[model samples]
Target: MMVDEPPASARFVVIGGGVHGLSAAWHLAKELTASGENPNVIVLEKSQIGAGASGISGGIVRNFYRSEAMTEVIAESVAIFEDDREGFGFHQVGYLAVVPEVQREDLEAIAEHQCEVGYESELASGDSNCREYLEWLWPDVNSEGVQAVLHEKRSGWADAIGTIRNLARHAREAGVRIFEGVEVIGLGYSGAEVSEVITSGGAIGCEAVIAAPGLWAPAWWQMQGLDPLVTIGEGDSAEQRPLTEYWLAREGDYLLPGVGLAGNAGRAAPVVHFDHTAPLYSDRDGELITDQPWGIYFRMGMTGGSVVGGGLPLEMGPDFELDPYGPENPKQLAGDDLSEFFTSGLAFALKRFRGASDLWDSNPNGGVLALTPDRYPVADWTAPNVYSILDAGHGFKMLAVGREAAREILGSAKSSLLAPFRLSRFGSGATHVVSKSPYPWT
Candidate 1:
């Protein structure tokens, strides 16, 4: 169905219609509607909803943070995922993070802290599941070395497309208008404030403008004479890049259906295979191989008894030019890089776990995605009347910024929820990045 355009006297004009953009429009529309004003909120998307990262994510939702601020804000988001069922379809399948035999003690200490704060995690042993994986899992613990899997029963994945679409639908029901397939050319700034947004469609006047362009933020920044650090490269490279060189990915975690009795009472649990690289991460620009033994696995998603695991974070290759604004090239871009990365993980899984990486098959990156600096996320106010939200490397789970961003755009008085990610942190001489575990799980 074709969308209808609004007259020049629109209430609010939003550019970019991803999770964050739609979230803002949804909340803001209701805010205006409640004030007895039939505010005409228009959201302009160059593509379809979730055409970028929001639609094609791994769909995991966990605050999993070493910082209190992140935890507190995400607490509000987690509540929406778990409690707001009619609004979105959320699944509590559970999450499992295995501790290597060598770093078992350190990881365990961190796990203890996480549990004390809000994580329901525990240490895993081989007997957690009497399966062949148990042989490789939790290989052996040397020293006070780590050899356990931290399990979080409350955290899990969700329906990415469903939630965003639901938000869009709710916004429309509340009298917000949407315009997809419309490209934003630039902004009409007067006295440092955006008066109107210039797009492929035409001029759209509004009381205020908010930009939640997500992966394509570089475009808007470039129009404003600001250059983003992320560069866009080709996804079709021929060079055989080492998996460990650019993306420190390994295949230790596979969704094994029926491993063992992985739960207590009604709670969900599964045996994790440690010892191996199911929990590989970036450390000193290489894979952290473990020699110790013993770990835990988990069986979540009651019906499917599914399993999940993560390796180390992917280090931006020296060749990786962080250009999020370059033209769409086909020679050697992240798409091919991800293709190779996923292929490598699958092949490694075949040899290591005797299975495959299901992310591709499940359309994990089903939406457009991008990586941010510090590899966490950016959720802060930029110029006046303009705010931003980017989850760096952890955008999926960190999408709590969706509602938070919405609240900010609506000018809600209680947007104190977003003080943590204020863009000023970059220039305030504030080294507030959480103490990262030697494990690059970001």
Candidate 2:
């Protein structure tokens, strides 16, 4: 969040305009009002809402994950997504994962895990509704020799822009003031804590602050006396071309049965949709898809899109400095980079679900922004009034609860809910690198 002009004073200041920041604002307002502590809650955005990677996210929500910490916390966010109708748009669609022969075991294992967590999921025969969902949606799904599929009824996609817009709107109604196009420059600390944030417009006094800079956070943290290994995806590469062929994913991404249609029956009985795979864009240059805000490539986005198009891969992207209230240097993406990504993705889809690749395009969607080092979100409470949720594999699925975590800093009902994920995990070396590839790991 950026403010062109500063407020004389505020009890709380939530930075960044992305989902996490917005969630913090919304939760802050709700919690504060409930406590009769009408603190001057402010949210500042340097650009328009969702300007960073939030708007472009391929909103996928699932409880089938490996990390206990992540799963537990995200479950709360999912509750927010599903429970609250006015502020978020999360409709329950079944995620029918058409299992490729090789990944059958892993998919089954994930299903069992989902059951342990109270998710109504099961393994289905190839001839069941899973197959029909595929056939219905991608009518031409090359089901030749396709294996059994796993179905989880809880997960599905959401309208990213709508979710954030709703959060901002509701936060406003709750009495939080949001200032777009305002650039936040530096942090002004008093004694040992943050006293105020300096913006291009002036200075805003605050008792607490939340720095949710997404991929730009490394630079932001650097500005605030920290260093994180941050880098942007090689937007796109030159040699690896986007090919419109088909190949079966062995131990790779999820295979959707299709939503609403036959490939998937809108039963809300299985998984909502198929997870996306990493596309091979080149033989030489290698750039990883950073786990940033924009990396939530549900299914089609990766398929019909290019791979190495001089832009960030999925939720991955380049590192940039941000003066929340100033001109942010946005990254540019383009070319065969996109074509190759789409080509590989479609090719994989063609192999997995039998002709599902045909549902996408031969080129990747260009003009999307992202932030990185997002495999898991980062959060730490340095003191009583400040905390940051920086690392997230795909933050959107957990935004609701992530905001709840932020609310703890500003005096929410249960701050203990966030204690498990505090920065102390990293300090104690309890933080570990996690990968939630639907199934079939690389």
* Best model per lDDT: 2
The digit string of per-residue lDDT tens for model 2 on 26-126 reads 78788778878784788878777787657655566666554555556666777787777545667566555554454455566666666666666667655
lDDT of 1 at 442: 29
Candidate RMSDs in Å, in order, are: 8.7, 9.4
In model 1, how large is the Cα lDDT of residue 256? Answer: 35
**Residue 416, candidate 2: C-alpha displacement in angstroms:** 5.2
User: How many clashing residue pairs appear in each of the predictions shown?
Assistant: 44, 73
Q: How well does each candidate superpose onto the true structure, as a TM-score? A: 0.69, 0.70
Q: How large an RMSD does model 1 have?
A: 8.7
Score each candidate by Cα lDDT: 0.53, 0.54
Off by over 4 Å in 1: 1-3, 101-148, 227-368, 434-441
Write candidate 1's Cα lDDT for 327-381 as tens digits.
2422212333343333333233223322333433221111223544334456666
What TM-score does structure 1 among the candidates reach?
0.69
Q: How far out, in Å, is residue 112 in model 2?
A: 3.8
Instruction: List the lowest-lDDT window of 10 residues for candidate 1.
Output: 237-246
